[model samples]
Target: MLTFYHAPNSRSTSIRQLILELGVADKVKTVEVTIPRQDGSGARDPKNPHPEGKVPYLTDGEDYVRERAAIILYLTDRFPEAGLGRPVGDAQRGRYLSWLIWYQGVLEPVTILNWAKLDHPAVKASLRDYDTALQRLDEVLGRQPYLLGDDFSAVDLLCAGPFAWFGDQMPATPAIRDWVARCMDRPAVRETAER
Candidate 1:
């Protein structure tokens, strides 16, 4: 059986929600682990396998997956029947991969930098600041309801993480706000948030 290492209210919530979305909750077991804070405040379980002591780690047999976007991709690909993943031959596969990668490589870092108030010119040059990032997202979302169009995919699931979790940190754009609300309305998402 697959075992998911989870921490309540963390990025792991999205993965747990994905499992529920796939209706494979019975196929996996969830194990809660404590990840020590960056300031070394919380308890860090020695039994936890996450290298950096983070939540949202997955152990499938001997295979371990970490990082939010990677974990979402792993789950979606593993359960392709859920139709949350755009597989290799799909025309939207490249776009799907781009959204997933962008969330981690671009959005996340930019969000962190913006929240930390580190608006250096060099940082803006590389990550383009949070407003630009949000506007870029809004441009795409304003065109379509989901990242991949009408149907919601894991891309939407994972991409909405920051907005849904951080809330007011995201810009007040209608496109983004509506998209986030739509994504949050998912039964699985509501259930996950309640936890």
Candidate 2:
């Protein structure tokens, strides 16, 4: 059986939601672990495969997958029957992959910096500011309901996870707001969010 290590309300929640969206909840077992707290006083679960004791890591048999983007890509590709991944030769596959990489590479860092108010010229130059990220997302979302276009995919869920949680940090773009709303409206997302 597949094992998923996660903590409620943490980055791992997105993985949980993705599993739910795949309708493979019964196929995998979820192991909840305490994450490192802001004060650095939480449990560093030995059972968790994450090197830093982070949540949202997945154990597939003897192999371990860490990082949100990696976990999402692993699960979606592993269970292609869910239709969440754009397989090879698909026209949208490139766009799909780009969104996945962009989420971790750009959006994640930008959100953290903006939230902490740690603005620096170098940081802005390397990893665009929050407003720029929002504008780019708005442009894509305005063109289609999901990152890969009309159909919802794991990219939608993965990308939406951050925006849904950090709605306050996002700009007042109707497209972004609507896309996030659509993502949150999914039954799987609501269930995982409640957990």
Q: Clashes in each model (backbone N, CA, C under 3 Å)?
A: 0, 0
lDDT of 1 by residue, 1-195 (tens): 778888777778888888899888888788888876657666877767888778788889889899888888888888889899888899999999999999898998998887787888988887788888888888999899998999999888888888888898656589988998998999998787777
Tally clashing residue pairs in candidate 2: 0
Q: Among these predicted structures, which one has the highest lDDT?
A: 2
Off by over 4 Å in 1: 38-41
Using all chains and alpha carbons, the TM-scores for the candidates as numbered come to 0.94, 0.94
Clashing pairs in 1: none
lDDT of 2 by residue, 1-195 (tens): 889998887888889999999999999999999888877677788777788889788888888888888888888888989999887787877888899999999998988888888989999899988899889988989888988888889988888887788776655489988998998899997797667
